[model samples]
Target: MSKCPRCFVSLTSDHFAWTQASGTTTEADPVASAYHGGQVLSRKIVELRRPVDAHAGWAPPPQHAELELGGPVREVCPTCHYVLVDGWRNAQVTCIAMAGARATGKTVYIAVLIKQLQLLGESWGAVVEPFDSTTEATYRDHYETPLYEARGILEATPAAHTGNPYQREPLIFSLGHWNNVSQILVIRDVAGEDLENPENARAPWLQFFAHADGVLFMFDPLKVESVTNQLHDLVPTQERVGGDPRTVLRTVLGIIGLGTPNLAIILSKFDALQSLQSVEGSDWSRIMSNPGAAFSRDFSLRSAPYHDGDGQLLNQEVRSLLKKLDATPMVMSVDQPHTGRPLPNRYFAVSALGESPVGDRLHASGITPFRCLDPVRWVLATRSVWHWQ
Candidate 1:
């Protein structure tokens, strides 16, 4: 069964609702109104009865005889009332939620990740495009223009309650049809401020994490004072830093509760750590200098599919690196989670900008992503959509 992009809730035959696009507008849908923070005009929401037999078919059950049928109708999630995309029920979706403290490079990672996904799709003779107009406009205005065209860092993603919280909408992309089904990718970026505070953990809007397919929780190395202190002399100091990662991780787990989404503990701003290879006599320098280490190179651009051997090596390397950065508590919690529902977890490191930004401006070297596709590929691979060659 496919899941709603906004709510991440499963859409079974028993749970289906829809609205017709007649020339009349009624009261706004409560869920849609809250999500978009505005009125969503449409006909009254009509709940469909579940089919009597399991083997009947996938189409919605016959509409009520009394309902007026004039124009096209759009299927919507019965729970959230958000309109489902055309042919969504027949499509396969991979829903991923982005979690991290402020300045962990979530916004920048997304901008670079989409471009890289397009390139990856080309390798498989497929096309990747935004699934909807909202995704395209949001990506272009909020994420792409500032970072790529203006050559500056993107403004922090606003919290859901803030005025103009564009992050509330999921960025949906169509990856063409694979395996006789339309493959879609849905990504939801959460503001760090929301995850850092305990109060927001219980907010109704934050419930999507409970059903997400994968949660990419980023841990910023730059947030660690020791790492920053070491790089003070070598690289320009980053002005913005997030709260304690341990606290943020705890908050994320609290929100997740018992959900079984795959957890990816990502180390963001890895370029800063990579720069430590030049710090003479330092243990980091020695560790990063190893020519054979998987973390030292990125082979994602190669024609071969994602290498499990390389990913496993990098996972071990990053797990140990997290320990070196004093993230032992976070690692221990993932192994023995407080929620008592252990999730399939992995360690990943990415450098979206390829180099540290000088203040608000990007590095002169331009954007060079490292291992940005690993997490998503891992999720898709499990479904047999994309696999290692």
Candidate 2:
């Protein structure tokens, strides 16, 4: 069975459910509201569970028990009540949850990642597109427009508890097909405010992190005082920043508990660090100046098999760079998770926008992403998807 595109929960055969696709009988649904972290007024939602006395292959009818209900009914996840996409069961899903503190450029990374993904797919005779209207509209209105059209930084993603948040749903995309199985990619963006406090770990909505295919844990280089001091002259003052990332990672890891998911520890806004290459006499300059280093340049010319040789090099290089930036604790947290269940992991460095925005506008040179695909490709490579083996 495939998983729910929104919540990342496996669509188990034990329970089946459907909700009225569209109905005038909207009411506050406490079950849906509880999973959403806010009130969710839903249509007539219905569910069924297997009876203990039923045979091994016993199954409920394709539709809800109340047959004469509505014009159309759609399947909904029994756990989170998110409407399932058509053919959700037959397709393979790659669900990734985005984790980061405030001002970590999570939105910006997503805005650019989609574009890069499209271009990469086009080169390899594949198509990547929004799976549903929700994805297309959300990407266009929330992610694509502000950055590509307006050429400005995206607003911080509002918390789920906020009124009518569009971010409550995952960004689902169809990645053509790999190995002849339709591949779906779902990205869940968690507001930094939601994950900032450890107490939020107890919230039911956070269960997705425990079940996601992978978690992209973004770490802002500028968060470190020493690094910020060095780049003071290069980039403008950051308007907003969040609490300690170490605390946020702990909260995320805590929520995951014993669940294991590939963890992509990303160094976000790496252009700030790349700028240090011009510092002439500093250690950062020398480190960033190594032309042969995997962090020095992008290998965008090739389609993967994920380039594991280079990936390994980049992993080691990023681990070393994190230590230099005084973020060893964050690395150790993932390496030796408090849950005592260490997830398969990798370290990555990416600059969604090639240069820091001189205030609200993107760099004058234009958006030249640096290895933004590393994390996503790493996840996809595991599935033997677009990166054909």
Candidate 3:
């Protein structure tokens, strides 16, 4: 049995109970349940104990229960009640959740990121593909179509009942195998509006962030006044929008509490910064055009498989960049908080769109993602899957 990527619940056969009906016969079996009870557990606390009659070294799950299935039974996550199928656990799963204010380029990132990952996975002898039917349909209809095929900016995600909330489901991917073990990646994208409104998070559904392996907190560079002003001539500037990053970050921290997960504070829509190179005489131009700078170069082409040092170097560069953007206070909020506790965090920059939207159309340069894989790579690196080059 393996753990659910979202809530870290031990996903064993026993926790699941389901029912199936064939003709006039109805069968039931154990499927899954919500993560109830207040008892907190670590990876070792709930060990899989096998039945006495089972094979040697096999262990039975403690939360084992039976399901009275009215139809075909399926496995599911005990934490979020998300269902899963066989062979889902035979991998090093990494779960990431996205948080930001609305129009932070998350939907575009998802569509383009998938294509980029597919390109990168080829070099590692891995094929990146959607894990389930839901992901395939959703990714194609909602995310992939408008962005990739139609070449337009994705519309704002509708509210839940509005029927077009782009994030109604998690994006699950199978990244082939890594070092004899399969690598499964699950990403949960939340509406920026949801994260912006902390008062609404009292519900139990929002609690999953507390257990995520990593949370991508997108800080839209376009939201920064100075940057927007400087780039107004080079790119189209829309009305100042999005809730304060500080507010959203604090809410995310509050939801997760003290759980140890990588917090990636990302400077999103970085391609606009890249365009600042045209400013010619300005300091921003020099910084933006510096070929040797971490942000200027795409390290994804490096021959080393996974170099922690390379990623850390980029982190330092981005930290300074964020300071330049006047996000220092937000950094402090993550480091030395007024609450006296800080999350294990890192700073990153990614340009999912690679350029600002020209009205409803994407810039002709096409989507060139920068450091987009950094956050996900860091989380997986923590599991010791690809720690060293």
Candidate 4:
């Protein structure tokens, strides 16, 4: 069964609600507002359910919305009230949620991830594109333009309560077909302010992370006092530094509760750490220059499959690196989650820009992503989908 792309909730064929598809005035919908964490204004809603002991098989009265109260109707999720896309019921959906503190390079990573996915899709003879109009427009305006075209830094994602926030909708992409079934990828981005507040924990709105197919928690190396002190003269000054990643991680884990989503603790902007190799005579230099370490190489683009051997190597290497970076508390939280049921998790390192920006502009060299796809592919491989040929 496919899940609702917006809410990541499992969909059922049993019964669903529908609203006029056209010529209807939008009004406040409390049910959707609850799931959205804000006021959701939409068309009037109507529900249809199968009668008990109806028959061996049952279907909606009509696939089309001719029996509409005001106009043609479309199906919606009974839980979140999200509209179901055409042929959505036939596809398999994978939901991924992005979580991290502010300035963690998440927006930069996303801008590059789509392009990489499209390039990979072409090589494998698979069609990959935005699944909906909102995704197309949002990606182009907010994500694609600033980083790729303007060659500048992206601003912090606006809070969810702000006017016209783009992150409210999920970025859904059609990954063509895999395993003889339609493959849909849904990525949801959240504002760091919301999660960093701590007050937001245990709130119903963040339930998406708990229910996600995978939740990626990104840690910023720049936030580490030791890393910053060592590289202060080597790298450009950071304009904005987010709150402690540990606090945000705890809040996110609190939201995830006991839900067993695969957690990927990604080390973002790892190029900054790699630059430590030049800090001669330091412990980081010796560690980063190991030559045999998995972090020393980039095999993400070359490999068609997500090899477990390589992934586990990188995972262990990152775990050790985190300890050195003073992130032991972050590691222990995942290793022994207070939820009592420790979730399946792995560590990954990704350099979205490959090089730090020179002020607001990108480095003179063109953008290059280092192992940005590793975390995503790790999640996909678990679902047995999109093993590139």
Write down the lDDT of every candidate, Cα atoms only: 0.84, 0.86, 0.70, 0.87
Superposed on all Cα atoms, the candidates' RMSDs to the truth, in angstroms, are 2.1, 2.0, 5.8, 1.8
Q: What is the lDDT of residue 51 in candidate 4?
A: 76
| lDDT comparing candidate 2 with the true structure | 0.86
> TM-scores for all candidates?
0.94, 0.94, 0.84, 0.95
Give every collision pair in model 2.
Answer: none
Between candidates 1 and 2, the one scoring higher on lDDT is 2
The list of candidate 4 runs beyond 4 A from truth reads 50-58, 61-71
Q: Point to the candidate with the largest TM-score.
A: 4
Q: Would you list the clashing residue pairs of candidate 4?
A: none
1-389 in candidate 1: lDDT tens per residue? 58899888888877667777554667766677654444556577777766677565655545551253445677888877888877788888889999989889899999998998899889888798999999999999988999999999999888877888888889999988877788888999988998889877776577788888889999999888788888899889988888778888888888889888888899988899999999999999999899999988887766466777788898999999999999999999899888776888889988888898898899899998888888887777666665643
Assess candidate 1 and give its lDDT. 0.84
Off by over 4 Å in 3: 5-72, 301-303, 386-389
Model 1 TM-score on a 0 to 1 scale: 0.94
Candidate 3: RMSD over Cα atoms?
Answer: 5.8
Q: Candidate 1: which pairs clash?
A: none
